[model samples]
Target chain A: MAKKPRKKAPKPTPKETAAKAKKPKHPDMEIPFLKNVLVLIALFFLTYYLVGNVKGYKWLQERFIEGNLNKLEKFADLTTDQKYQAYFRFNHQFLTFIRDNTADTAIIYMPPDSVLDVEDKKSAFYTKKRSNSVQHKTWSTYHIYPRKLVYDREKEEIPSFDQYTHVACVDGWGYEYLEYDVPKQQRARYQVLPRTVKGLKAMNEREKNQAQ
Target chain B: MTLIHLIVLFLCGFGLMNLISPKFGLLEKIGFSFPLAHGLVTLLMLPYDLLGIPITLTSLYIPQLLVIAFVGGWLFYKQQLPQAVRIQDWNKAKSFGFLSINLPWIFLMSILGYLLYVVIAKAMFWPTISFDSVAGYDFVGKMIAIEGKVNGSMFDPDLPFYSIRSGYPLYVPGGFGYAYLMGFDSSKITTVLLILSTVVMYYALLLNYVKHTMAALFTTLFITTTEYIAMSALSLSNVPHTFLAVAAVVTIFIWMDKRDHRYFWLGVIFMALNVWARSDGIVFIAGTGLSLLLFAYQEKKWKELIIFGAVSGAAFMIWQVYLSGTLGITNDGVFVDHLFWDGEKFDRMTDLIWRVITNTQFYGVAMIVIPIGILANFRTIHKQHYHLLIAILVSWLAYTALYYQMDNGGENFGYSLKSMINSSYKRGMFAIIGVLYFYVGISPMTQKLSQLIIEPGNPFKPKQ
Candidate 1:
C-alpha cells in the first residue's frame, strides 16, 4: 500500500550556517590589514580621548593630590586645590570660587581679559537668577549681570573707592577674586582685610587686602 | 528635589513614549530602542503649546500631563504583549564579544562620556552665560522654568531693553519648564538631558540601517566627539532640529524597509516637530518629506504617498498659518532683509561659505570623511542609496542657498556675508551627518562585517 518515499532534507551550506566569516572589503579600505591596524590606532586615540584630553579627570585628580579634598567642602576651605587650579587649569580655581559663591546680586569688579575662560564666565551665571528688567550684555568678559564694572571709574593708580563687593584680578602669576564679606547695605572698603588670605597669601596684598 | 524631578519627568516622558511607540510600531520594528524617549520628551511641549496648555508646576498642569501618561501607559499595557519566555539555560545567550563590538557599545560609551561631561560641565559651566543662551534661547528657558509659563512682562517691548527674539520657538523653554515643574532647579540639567536624548535617539536611528560597528564608529567620530555636535546638540534650536531630522530620515528608512503606515505616522510627527523647532526646519521637513514621497511613488504605493503628502503638507500649512498669525508677516523689516538676496551678495556669501567649509573646526574630520566616503562609494550612492542621498542633497542645497540668500541688508556686502556665514554655516552644515550616515551604510560591506565580528550561529545574523 503505497507510502511514498519521504523526501530527504537538504543540508545547509556553510555560507548559510555557522562557519568562518569573510572579512569585508571597504572601498575606503583597499588593504584589510592596514585598515584593521588603522582602526586599532583610531581606537587607541579614542581611548586616549576619553582618558586624557577631557581634562575633567585631570582637574579632579589635582583636587585629590594624595588622600585630600574630602574635607574641602566649602569653597573657602578649598585653598590648596583652588590655587593649583588657578595656576594649572587656567583660572578654574578663581572661576569655581566665583561660580559657587558669587550671588547674582553681588556687584563684582572683574579685570579686563577678553581671552579669559569664556566657559568660566558662563558658569558664573548659574548663580544668577535671570532678571527680566535688567538686560544682560551678551559677550562681556564679566558674567551676565545687571551691573558689570569693567574698570574703576576714577582711573587713579589704586582706583577709586567704589561699591564692588568682589575684585576678580588676573595678573601675570595667576588669578584670584577677593570677595569682601560685609553687611548688605554697607560697602566694604578694599583696604582693611588681613593681607594674607586663607594662608595662601593674596596676590596683591596691598590692593586686595586694602580694607577701610 | 533633583532626583524627584528627574523621576517624574522620566515617568511622564516614558509613558507618552509607550503610547507613541505602540502606535508607530517603533518598538516592534526596532526591538526595544530608546528612540521613544527622544520622541516623547522633545515632543511633550508640542501638544501643550498647540492645545493652549499653560505650562505650570501646579496640580492643574501636572494632572494634565499625568492624564496623557496614564492613558498612554494603559494602551501600552493593553496591547498584544510579547510572550514571556522561561529561562531554562544560560547556554543560548550571545557572547560579550559580539555584544560589545556593535552599535549598542558605541551608544553606551558615548552616553558614559556624555554623562561624565555633563557632570563636569554642570559643575563648571552655567549654560545661561553662553552667548546664544543669553541672547535668544535659554533666557526664555530660564523664565519658563521659574515662572512656569512665558512671562509676558519680559516680552513687553515697552520695558527697558527687552532683547529676546519675538519669533523664537518655545520648545527649549517649555522643555526646561517641564524640568522645573518636576522640581529641578538648574537649567543646565535640562540642557544636559536634551543633548543626551539627542545622541541616544540618533544612535537608535543609526542602528536602523547601519551595521553595529559602523554605526558606532560614525556616531563617535562624526556625531559624539565633534565639539560642534557636543556643544550644539542641546544648544537652542539645534538639538531639536537635529532630533527631528534624524527621526524623519530614520522613519523614512524604516518605512522603506517595512512598507508600513505606522512608520509614516512617526515620520510625519517628526516633520511636524521639525517645523515647530525652528523656521529653517520647514525646508528640512519639506525636503525629507518630498524624498519620502518620491520613494513611496517608486514603490508604487499611491495610497501611502498621497496620504503622507497630504498630512505633511497640512501640518506645514497649519504651523505656517499659526506662525504668520502670531509672529506677523513682515515685508520690509527683519524678515524681508533676510528674504531678498542681491546677486552680488549671493556671490560674496558663496565665497564666504566656501571659505567656512574649507576651514571647518571640530567637525573637520567629518568634512574630510564625508566627501571621501561619497566619492569612494559613488556607485553605491548613485544606484542603491539614492533616496538617502536625495534627502541629504535637498537639505544641504536648500540650507546652503538659505545661507547665501539671507542678507542683513548692509551696504558693505562683505561683512553681511561674513556675519551670515558666522551665524549659520556650522549649524547648517550639520546636514552632512545624513550624507555621512548613508555613506557608512553603503560603505561598511556589512554582511562580511557581521560575519567577522559576530559569532558563528549568531542570533543577530544566523545566516551570515
Candidate 2:
C-alpha cells in the first residue's frame, strides 16, 4: 500500500491525544485561598491531636520494673552483698527511669525515717517530738529533694516550674516535702547521694534550725 | 568522643548529606545540617554501655532516621523551597542568603551553648548546682531518665502541668532527648540541644529574610542576642518558649502577608500550643492576635479582620474552656497564683518597658529598642510599605500600654513592666524586627546592598 502514504498515522483530535497547554491566566494561582483554608483545618487538627492524646503519651514502664527488694523478699536468706546489689540495681534503674522520662526535670523525696540509722538514737534521721500533734524531723542531711516545675513569669529569675514530693518511710516519722532540681547526669554515677541520712555528717544546730 | 572528633563527624555527615541531596533549597539545606545534629546527638551515647549509641537502638535505627529526615526535609523543603528558589535572580541573592544572616549568630550561640553545657554539666558535681539546674531542667531530665518518657507535672505541680509547658517541645526535646536515649550524658546533649535550636531559628529566620517573609525573625534574634534574652535562656524555661512564640509569630506573619489565611489558622493553633509551651506564650498569642485584628481593620482587609477575630477569639475561648472544664480554674486564680509565688515581682519588671519608650534613666536597658525604631523610620521612607512599619510600632507600643494599664495603680507598676520586658523583650522585639526586615528589603538601602553586597543575578529582589 506504498507504506500507506509513508505510514502517516491519523492525527489525534484535540480531546484524544493532547490539547495545547493553556496558561494559568492569573499569576496569583499560587495564592490559592482554598489551600489556606485547608491548611487552617490541618493545623486545627494537629493542635487537637497533640493536646488531645497527651494521656496516651504517658509511659507506664516504671510500674512494670522488677525491684531487687522483691527478689530479696522471695529469697530471704540472701547474702548482704546480694541484697545490696539488688538495692543498687533497683535504685539505679529507678533514677535512670526518672531522668529518661522528665528530660532531667524531676523531684526527689526521702522519708524522715530513712534520713539516718534506725538503731542509733543519735542518728541523722532522728527527729525531736515538738508536740503531740507536731513532730520535728531533721530533714537537712539528705538534700536530694524532688524536682517540681513551678510557673515563674520573671524570665531571668528562678524557674517557674518546680518539683514537689512527699517522702514517707516504713517507720511512723511522717512525710516530708522535698523540692530540688534533677541531679546532674555525669555526677549521678560518682556521687553516693547520701542513700541514708547517716551518710551525710554535715548537719549542725544552725543547719537544723534552717531546715525547720 | 572529643569535641574535635564530634566536629569531624559532623562535617563528614554534613558532607554526605549534601552529596546525597538532589538539589539546593529548603530540604537540601536542612539535609546538610540535620544529619550533623542527629549524629552529634547519637554520638553522645558513646559513654553509656546500657544506652549505647542511639543508632544502635532499634527505635532510632538508620532506616527510621532516614525516613524521618526525608519527611522532615521534604515538608520543610516544600515550605521553604517555595520561599527560597522562587527568587528570580540567584546572583542578586547574598552569599548563602540563609547561611549568612544566621551563621554569624549561630556560630556564636553554639560556642556559648557549649560553654554552658560544660560549666553546668561538670560543675554540677558541686553542691551549688543543686539549687538551680537540679530543680530546673536537670530535675526534669531525671524524671525522663527514670521514666523513659516525658511528663509535665514532674517539674512543678503548682503550675499548669496539663499543657506542653513543663518539658521541651517536639523538635527541641527530640534533639536533647535523642542524645540521652542514645546513651550520651545529658550535659553535652543539653548543649547540643541549645545549639541546634539556635541554628533552627537561624535558618528559619534566614528563609523568612530570603523571601521577604517577615521582619520579626531578625528583630527577635537581635533582641535575643541582647543580655536580657541571653540571661533568660540561661536561667529558665523561656528558651523553648521563645522558639514556640517565634514560630507562632512567623505563622501569623505569613498569614498576614499572603492572606492565604491558612497561616492564620496555623498561627492560632501555634498560639494555643504556645500557652502550653510556657505560661507567657498565651499572652504573646493574645497580644499578637489583637494586633492582627487591629491591623486588618486598619488596612480595610475585612476578610482578614473577620478571620483574625474568629480565630483569636476561638483560641482564647478554647483555653478558657480547657481551664474551666479540666481544672475548674479561672483566670483570676491563675493571675493571683502567678503574682504571689511565680517570681514575677511585677513592679520592677514593668519599669523596663516604660524606660525604653520614654528613654528614661536606664539608658542601656533600653538600648535594644534603637534598631527597631530605626527599622520603622526607614520603612516610612517608602509610602507603599509605610503602614507595615506603622502597624508594628503601634502594636509594640499598644502592648507596652496594655501591660502598663494592667499594672496601673498597683505598687511598683514600673517594676512589673520591667519584668515583662526582661522576659518578653526578645520576642516582642522580634515581631517588630521581622516586619522591619521586610521593610528594609523593599527599601532603597536593600537595592543598594543588593548591588554592592550581593552578587549579580541575586535572587533577592525587592517586591514591587
Candidate 3:
C-alpha cells in the first residue's frame, strides 16, 4: 500500500506555449445581416423623426413648395420695378413718383417725419403703422439716386439746402416750398413740385407778409 | 450672358485653385470656384475705384481670363491636369449593393434635392426687397454700377444719404454690382449662386469625413437651419457671411486633421475671403488663427503660420486703410477700442445666447443634436476634437464679447442691445451651427456608428 504512488505529467515546450498564446480564445462573431438592416432602419427612422419634429417637412411644404414654387409663375413675368412695386406697394410707388418727376440733377427738399407720420384719412400718405418710409432720407435716396435729398432736421448741417430745385410735398406739407399753386383736382397726396424762382419769390413774400 | 459670366468666373476660380495646388477633388474645384472668383473680382473693384478706372465688366472679365489662361497653361505644361474623374468609390459601393443595403441615403438625398430646388426658386423669383438690401447694399451696388465707381456721387460730402451699413464692406454690394454689370435685371442672382455654391461645397466637404448617408443627413440639417434658409431667399449679408466664415473654419480644421499643405493654403485663402465678405468675420479669423498658432508652434511650421496671418489679415487691414486713409471716413465711435467688463451685460448676453441656441425654431434640432453628440463622446473629447471645440468656443466668446463692448446706444436703424442680441447675434449663430454639425459628423461616435452601418461584421466582436 505504501509503494503505490502516481506519476507526474511532463511540461509543454516553449514553442507549444507560444503557439497556444497566439491563438484567440474565442472565434470572431459576425453580426447578422438582418440585425444590420434593422439598425439602419432604426437610424433612418430616428433621423426622419428628428427632422420632422424640427418642422423640416412643414417648411419644405409650406415655405418653399407652396410659398415659392407655386408662385413662381405668377412672379416670373414681373419686371424688376414691378416686383419692387409688388413688395413695397405704396411706399415704392411714392418713391418712384419722386424719381420720375424729379430731374437727375435736381436737389430735393424732403418733407419732415411729422408730415409722413400723419395718420388722418386725408393727410396720411402711409396709412399703415409703418410710417416715415418716404421721410427716411437714406431709403428715399436709394430709390431716387443721383438726385440729392435735404432733410429739414439736417438742412442747417447740410449746406446744400439752398440749392434745392424741387420739393417733395407729402400730404400738402411741402407746398410752401413750391413756387406754383396746385389745383385741388390735380393735387396728389404725394407729389414732387419744382422749386422755381416764382415759388421762392412767393415764399419770400409770404414770409415778408408774416413778418409785417 | 449671365451663364457666360458665371462660367468665366468658375474657370477663374478653378485655375486659381489649380495654381494653389494641383491635387484636388473635382467637386472641391467646382464648389470653391465661384466664391474665390467673386472674392477676387470684388476685391479688385476697390483698387480699380481708387485708381479711377471704371469697374466695367470688361475690366473684371479680362483679368479673370488672363488668370485662367495662366493657370491652365501652367497646369498643362506641368502635366498635372486631372486625367479622369475619380468616382470609382461610388461605382464600387453601388456594385457591392451598398446603396440597396443602406436605403436611407435615398431619403436624405431626396430631402436635400427638394430643399435646394425650392430655395433656389425663391431666391431667383424675388427681387431685392429686404430693408437692409434696398437701403444699403443694393442701393450702393446700383450706384456703383451706374457710376462705375465705389466713390460715386453717393459718397459726396454734400449728400449724406447713404446708411451706416453702406460703409461696412463692399463684398455684398460688389456682388450685386457685378450682377448688374452682367446685364441681369435683378441682382438676386448673386444670392442664388452663393446659396447653390455653398450647398454643393458643404456637402462635398462633409463627404471627406463621413459616409454618404451621414454627409447627406448633416447637409440636410445645415440647409434647413430655419432662420438661415428663410433669410437665404432674401439678399442679406448674414447668410453669405455664414457661408464664407463656415467654409474658412471647416477647411482650417480639415487641414489640421489631414496635414495637407493644399488644405492649409485653401483655408488661408478662404479665411481671407471670410473677412472680405464681412468685416465681423475677423472674429472667425482670430479663432482660427489662434488654433493655427498652436498647430504651427507644435509642428515647427513657422512659415505656414506667417502666410496664414498675412493673407488672412490682409483684407481687414486694407479695408481699414481704405476707410480711414483714403476715403477720409473715420469710425464715429461705433466699436469700443478697449476691453471692459460689465456683469449685467455679460449675464444678459449669456441668457440671450442660451435662449437663441436652445430655440428649435431658430436653428432646428442642430442645438439639440450637437450637445447630445458631444456629451455622448465626452471620454474622447480631449484626445480627438479639443482643437475644433476650442476654436468654436473662442470664436463664439469673441463674437459675444465684441457685441457686448459696443456703443450700441444710438438710434442707428432702431437696433437696441436686446434687438441686436435677438437678430444679429442670432444670425451670426449660423456659422456656429454649421461648424458644430461638422464636428458631430466627424466625431468618434458618429464614425463608429457609420462603420457599424457600412461594415458587415459585428463592430463589438473581439479581434482574433
Candidate 4:
C-alpha cells in the first residue's frame, strides 16, 4: 500500500512564539524575579543555619577552653596545661584580682610562652596597642602592673622581693597565691584570694601604717 | 566625621578612573553601583603611593579637599555632575517596569547590606586577634599610620617574629595607613572596605561574561559566605591578598575569552600588583600567566604572547627593585624548607586537601556538587575550558606544594597537621573558590541540579 500522506505540523501562533522565546534554558532560571526572591529567602534561612553553627563553635570553644573566654570561672582545679589555656583568656581577671586584693608595692612574675615566640615585653606592646590591651597578653606577660611591679619571670631577671612585705601570684592560671612575710620565722599564706586581715597580724599592721 | 569627606574622595576617585579608561565604561555599565565604585576606589588605593607625599591626616585630608574643589568646579562649570556618579546603574535599569533592582528588592538588598556592614564594623572594632595580624600585618600598618611613613623598624632584626613578617608586601599596609591618615585609624574600616571593593570588583568582572543570575549567585556565594573571608574580617591577612589573586585569574580569562585589551592590561596590572599584595600572590599570578601563555601559544597570538611575557617579567623585577631599594627589606635567603621532610607532611597535606574540598563554611554544598557536576557535564567542556582548568589547577596546586616547604612542623605530626589546617588551608581555599564557581557555572549539570532542587515542577522541564 502507498504510504499515507504525511501530516504537516501546524505553525505556532504568535503568542506561542513569544512564550517560546521567553522560556528559560533551565527551569530554575524561570520567573527570575520570583527565583531571585525565593533564593534570597532561602538565603535568610541559610544565614540562620550558619549562625547556629557559629553558636556550636562557640560552645566547643568553651568546653575545651577555660578562664574568661571559658566564662572566667574558678580554674583552681584544672590541670596545669588546662590552666595554661585558661590563662590565655584570663589576663583581664588577673588584672582585676591584682588591683582589688594585692598591695601596690607587690611585684608579679609572668612567664612568657616560648611557643608564642614573643621576643620580649616590647613585642606585645606594639601588637596590643589598638586594643589598649595589656601587652597583647592574655596568657602571661609583664604588662599587668596596674599599680604593682609586674616583672617578666626568668628567675635572674626578677628583682629581690624582700623589700615588699606581700607577694601575690595573679596569673589566674597555675600556682595562685598571695602571701605576707611575718616578722618572725613563720609566714602567713592565704588559701583563698581577696583575703583580708582576719589572720595575719603583720599584714594588718602594714595596712594600718599605709592608712596612717 | 562628616562621612562626606569619604564620600567626596571616593566619588572623585571613581570619576578619575572613568576619565582615565573609558573602555568597559565602568560607570556606564554599573553606574555608581557597588562594583564600579569599588573598582575606582581600588585603582585609586592600589597605586595610592603615586600621591607622593607622607600619608598624614593633613596629606590625605588635603587631597580630598583638592578633589572636592575640582568636583565642585566641574559641577559649577558643567552645571551638573555626570549621571554616572549621580545615580547607580541599579537605580537606572528598566527592569520590573522601573529602574533597576526595584522595590522590596531594594529593601532586601538594604537588609543584606546592613548585615554586612554590621559584620564589617564589628570586625573593625575588634582588636587584632589573629597571630599573623598582630605580629606582622596590622603591626606594620599601625607603625606606618603612627609614623606617617613606611618605618623600617618593622624590619627589626632583634625579634625573630618581625623577620618572618618583614618580607610581607606593603600595599595592604599602605592602604591601611592611607585610611589612618584620613583620620579613620581603624584597620577594620580599611580591611572591610578592601573586602567590599574586592567583592564588588569581582562581581562587576563576572558580569562581563556570564548571565546575570549566574553572576549574582556566584558573587553571593563566593563573597558573602566564605569562612576565611569572615575569619579575616578582623585582620588584613588573607582577604586582601585573595582579592588580587582572584582579579589576576578572572581578568586574564576575560582577556583570553573576549580578546579585550582593557581586560589584558587590567589583568597584567593585577598580576604585577598581586606581588605587592602578598608574597605568595606570585603563585596565583604566575599560574595564571602560565595558563595565558599556553592559551596564546595554542591560539598563535605571537605579538600578544611577547607583550604579555615582557610586561609580567618586568613587573616582577620592578617589584623586587621596589622591595630591596625603596622598602629596605633584604630577603633572609631561601626559607629553610627543612619542614619538607618534617613530621606528618603527607598527613598534613591530606588534611588540607580535605578542608579545602569539604569545608561547609565557604562553599557550602558546592564541594560535593562541583566534582559531580563536572563529571556530569564533562562533554560540555571545550578546549578553551581545558586551558582555564589548567590555570585553576596550577594556582591551587602551587600553594598546596608550598605548604610542604614551610617550617610549621610543631611538636608532633598532629601538631604539624593542625598548623597546616589553621591558616594554610584557608589560603589554599581562597585560591580555588572563584575557579570552582566558574567551573560549576559552566557545567550543564549544575543548572539541572539547581532546577531539580529549587524548582522541581516547572512546566518547561523536559521529560526523561
Best by DockQ: 3
Indicate the worst ten consecutive residues by lDDT in candidate 4 chain B: B27-36
- Name the docking class for model 1: incorrect
The alpha-carbon deviation from the true structure for residue B45 of candidate 1, after best TM-score superposition, in angstroms, is: 6.0
Model 2 DockQ vs. reference? 0.03
Task: Please identify which of the two predictions, 1 or 4, would achieve the higher TM-score against the true structure.
Answer: 4
Clashing pairs in 3: A179-A199
The TM-score values for the models, in the order shown, are 0.63, 0.44, 0.87, 0.64
Of 2 and 3, the candidate ahead on TM-score is: 3
Q: Each candidate's DockQ score against the native complex?
A: 0.06, 0.03, 0.18, 0.05
Between the candidate structures 2 and 4, which one is better when assessed by DockQ? 4
Instruction: Write one digit per residue (lDDT tens) for candidate 3, span B206-232.
Output: 877876667767888888888888888
| Residue-level lDDT tens digits of model 3 in A1-212 | 58867787789899999999654322122233575467657867876676567664456556657778768877788876788777666667777887876668878887777776635556435545342266667777777777878987786797666888888887667877666676777777777777896655655676588789
Q: Which digits, one per residue and each the tens of the lDDT, describe model 2 over residues B1-464?
A: 43543443344444333333423344324423433344333323222313433223344444444644654466466564344332433434432333234222333344345434433432221221222233344444443444444432343334332222223222333334454444554434444343344445444434543422112223333333333232332323444444445545655665566565544554564454455434434456555666576566767766755665565455456545644454344434112223332235445545555454333221222333445445545654554444444454555565554454444335423334445565445334533443444445445444444333222233466645
Error of 2 at B91 (Å): 13
TM-score of B chain for each model? 0.78, 0.52, 0.94, 0.77
Q: Write the per-residue lDDT of candidate 1 for residues B148-171, one digit (tens) a residue.
A: 445333343222112434345554
TM-score, candidate 1, is 0.63
**Ranking of predictions according to TM-score:** 3, 4, 1, 2
Angstrom error at residue A24, model 2:
32
- Give the winner by TM-score: 3
List ranges where model 3 is wrong by over 4 Å. A1-48, A55-60, A71-79, A118-124, A127-132, A181-186, A197-212, B83-102, B411-414
Better of 1 and 3 by DockQ: 3
Checking candidate 4 for backbone clashes, the offending pairs are B124-B188
